[model samples]
Target chain A: MSEINSSKTVSIISRQAPYGSNRAHQSLDIALAAAVFEQAVNYIFMGDGVYQLLGNQNATSIQSKTLVNALETLDLYGIESIFIDSQSLRERNLTPKDLALNASIVSRGEIAKIVRASDSVFNL
Target chain B: MSTLHTVSKAPSFRLLETCLSIIQAGDAVLFIEDGVYHCQQSTELLRNSEVKFYCLREDLIARGLIDRKLDTIETVNTQGFVDLCVQHDGIVNWF
Candidate 1:
């Protein structure tokens, strides 16, 4: 068994679209909680999750809180190290310029490596 | 190695099964998000597993299934959820 350590790394992987649903938001809430607790937290956006980072989101049309607005609060909460899958963005015809917030773009292989390094991972 | 498996969707069972196959005893499986619905179904597969099973209390409440009786499954709140992550050495997400 691996020896337990005082510091923990938690990774939150967002795979749902922004708005029109509560899954992605709830996931962010947990991520924020872990960050506030002073834990090492990382957020990864993959699959349809890349859409959550798209810029200029206005959820008023759908009667939902904009996802980008929620994500903007991450840095303030000490939850840095946000990443998005490059392939996901490419598949959706989106680029980093389309994202409202700044985040590193990573390949699937890189994402796998990040997951391997994390002590705990939450998918939503 | 101690692996913490978190499942949040019923469709994720395929991935969860794959994870369970690789994980031995002494590991834990936590069901959260919409994954809490999986706990409601009683099946031979679940009955046979030695892995520790857990459900998120807040998720169950949100789904209006909090009052339902469950067998062989432990319910945990957000704090307990954080504790679980701390207790396990690794985490696998099945969405």
Candidate 2:
């Protein structure tokens, strides 16, 4: 990469559920890695992706590490900027009260702004 | 003004059928990712309808179904896929 000196802002949009496939996990890993590399990584949960933040997820029942638990470790990774699509939560009949973590609840316009501000965007 | 419906999931996901419902008669469909599996069972459906069906060639080969007859369905490269998207007026990425 030519601009190796500059740390770019990378945005990841997870539009899938956390439990079904490894897409959610892989997406998270990318964000964590980017953050570790000192990139300004912004996470936006949209559509089915918003389900990732549901409280009290029990992965032990499925014999897997709870993604919700892994999500808790984001703070240790230095990922403090998280945004959730307010409209998506509304469409899913969920409220911010139901979320496992505290994040900025943004509108569609704000979501657009977040994407626009980033140098790169990823989706899973 | 035709729609290019891009499907990334297999029929087992029920996304192919859902994508079909929204596609008009003159629209086209481009199968990518696991959607290439639907191409195996979609030949008959495409031949009888006005809709044109296509799948990514690399994905077909990756799935080890390159020799599959394909019949009325066309196999295209990544560039060809971009051309198809450009030719269409709209695109629907069905999950």
Candidate 3:
């Protein structure tokens, strides 16, 4: 997959809340897959997607897989370009301490640029 | 790179609000389905000059918002919607 010097940049914008639907999980999988292939991946959490990063998300009671467990493998997969929308966090009254992962808090304007720069974008 | 964002929900859901936050200058937003309701509101995004605003003509007519829509909003038909998509680099749909 890394035969070429330059790989296409892919941006995965996950905007759905965890536990409610499969979108959040699917987006994460896509990001990891892109990273595995040596593609430049940008994982952006916006709108309700930011909720997927909240700490203490235990889904055992709901009989579902814990998202945090999968999130823990992101570093191992080399997908480090994680971004959280600042406006979404402020609107939800949440901060970095409330989340389980370390991500760059970026303004929406900056996010727009990220989407524009990406060779391909997947909005889930 | 300019983007064409499409909002399909009403203002009450805040989808448009979130979408507006990410819009940049030279970008365009198209209101479709229930999103036409946004045209009737007095939201500040409608007054924004940096980005352009467009709404589906059929959706607005279906919702009886023809006379109520803001003059700042440009009404477009299905063909125009496809044209907008082709004119932009990307399209993000806000449900």
Candidate 4:
């Protein structure tokens, strides 16, 4: 059982905004925590979660830490596999260029394939 | 085959109702996280169903609901939680 969970691919689906709420941060934290355990972790940004990737975020005005800055720490945590939903980006009128981070834009079908392949999926 | 439905919210019983209607008898319903709070009151959802109901032992303890009247709800530990998931064919997390 430990072997299955240890070798299992986990996909963390983020569906909320980055700031003003704990959901998105908690999702990222869980991914980071799982990665530390040497588990395979993949991140999927959809819906309002795409906002976390937006560049030039200045949360100082609101006395909050910029979510984009926190997201930049993912690479250092060894979590490189990241994806953004194409339809969600279109709906939000955002392009890859608007994002501070580099990630693949995936179709909904592709997202489903990732979920199906994962041994466990954590949705936020 | 049975499916383990993990509920994580208090007012999210709408999905539970839908799940109960579709699930066959002898299937189990294990409530965890904040959903364990719902075990306090006997709702229509709990009264009419023949499905076995359960709650996370640790969660109930954490919430200070230990020794409370939880109807027919049984408590299971994390290991038991995993076992229940393994016993079931699928898992539907309703949060």
Candidate 5:
């Protein structure tokens, strides 16, 4: 039995790139926390947010931890479903191979469907 | 005396527009944080040759924008940021 009375489907749409702002971290943290609570969490990377999935990131010089570390833990928390906007990736000249994690490349219509199915939406 | 204008937000915000409008010749604008996204809008900034343009190298690299950065804007490190501050008489922060 889940701890919470209602397990709402929470969707976190991250639009900012990692290290540029805290929004990316904030979204990941919330998604993990929500998943821990036994809620169905959907994490979607769009726009600049797609940059968060890029590999070969070393933030040591900047004195910041690489967000990819936390991103790797999402699956361990049972948050397996990760989505990335296809247009965003194409516009940024990034391909699925460039990302550190495995995420489903979704279109605008598909993204809208996910958002619509979500019980709660957080656009960061 | 010159000013070191720091922009920490994206061009989507009117802050950059306003900052550019009021910036004087010899002033420098340093794009930090999300401001590095302004690399896409470098052509607009090029209109003012008198004003200098810079971006935090760490921030740019973190966003995977190092290769995509424009030639006109110089990349600087944190230490270089401090140097720019020292070189200017005042600082203007545009959020």
Candidate 6:
């Protein structure tokens, strides 16, 4: 009972790619903190957010920090429920093999279940 | 259980006004990115209520509006930004 009371599930929705704005990094920061606190974390890549999962990103040309390294660390934090939007991936012509990290390709219906199960949702 | 509302757009955007309307009495509002340009306009939101107001220090310096901030709008760094997020049960990013 104590364990159940102490842990809250947090869903962090990332909706943008790296380099274009600061949001991608900011959302990661929140997820990192939530993981450290031992909360169950779900990092959902939605809409443009799926772009963040692309592998071998080098922002050096753009003079921005590459999130490729951080994206790889999601598994280490016990945040195993990373979900990428299926529609977004198909629209962008990307496949699971294109992403740096492995993620569940979820349809909108599956995504809704994830959201409904969360105690809190962070929109970034 | 209050919400930490983050606004990253300028006052001209409907986002800022929409945030103001939905914010409850105890909610905290933080101005980030171009949202710092609207710090003065936000003063009206805090005039009669207990809603907390903060602006990201780095964003304010970048925009060159440091000296003109209203007395009520406190400035916070990135760590403070994280603390605010933790203090609230929920977060609403009004982009």
List each candidate's DockQ score.
0.21, 0.06, 0.49, 0.06, 0.02, 0.11
lDDT (10s digit) by residue, model 3, range A48-117: 8999999998999999999977986798999999999998899899999999999899998899889888
**lDDT for each residue of candidate 3 in B29-62, tens digit (9 for 90 to 100):** 9999999999997777688888899999999999
RMSD in angstroms, all models? 8.5, 7.4, 2.7, 7.4, 14.6, 8.7
- Candidate 6 structure quality by residue, lDDT tens digits, A19-77: 78888999899999889889999998876788888887888888877897898988898
Which candidate model has the greater DockQ, 1 or 3? 3
Which run of 10 residues does model 4 chain A get worst, by summed lDDT?
A: A1-10
Best by DockQ: 3
Q: Give the clashing residue pairs of candidate 4, or none.
A: none
Kindly report which residue stretches of model 2 are placed more than 4 angstroms away from their true locations once superposed: A1-4, B1-95
| Model 1 deviation from the true structure expressed as Cα RMSD, one decimal place | 8.5
Backbone clash pairs in model 3 (N, Cα, C under 3 Å; residues 3+ apart or in different chains), count: 0
Each model's TM-score for chain A is 0.90, 0.94, 0.94, 0.91, 0.95, 0.92
Tell me which of candidates 2 and 5 scores higher on TM-score.
Answer: 2
Show the colliding residue pairs in model 3: none
lDDT of 1 by residue, A1-124 (tens): 4744466888888878876578799889889888877889889887778888887889889887887898987899888799988877898999898988888888766776677677777877
Tell me the tens digit of each residue's lDDT in model 5 across B1-95: 67787889887774566556546668799999999998855566556888899999999999999999988899999999999999986665655
Task: Name the Cα RMSD for model 3.
Answer: 2.7
Rank by DockQ (best first): 3, 1, 6, 2, 4, 5
TM-score of 6: 0.57
Which of 1 and 5 is ahead in DockQ? 1
lDDT of 3 at A110: 94
Q: Count the backbone clashes (under 3 Å) in each candidate.
A: 0, 0, 0, 0, 0, 0
lDDT of 2 by residue, B1-95 (tens): 56677889877776665455435667788889998987776544456477888999999999987887367679999999999988875565666
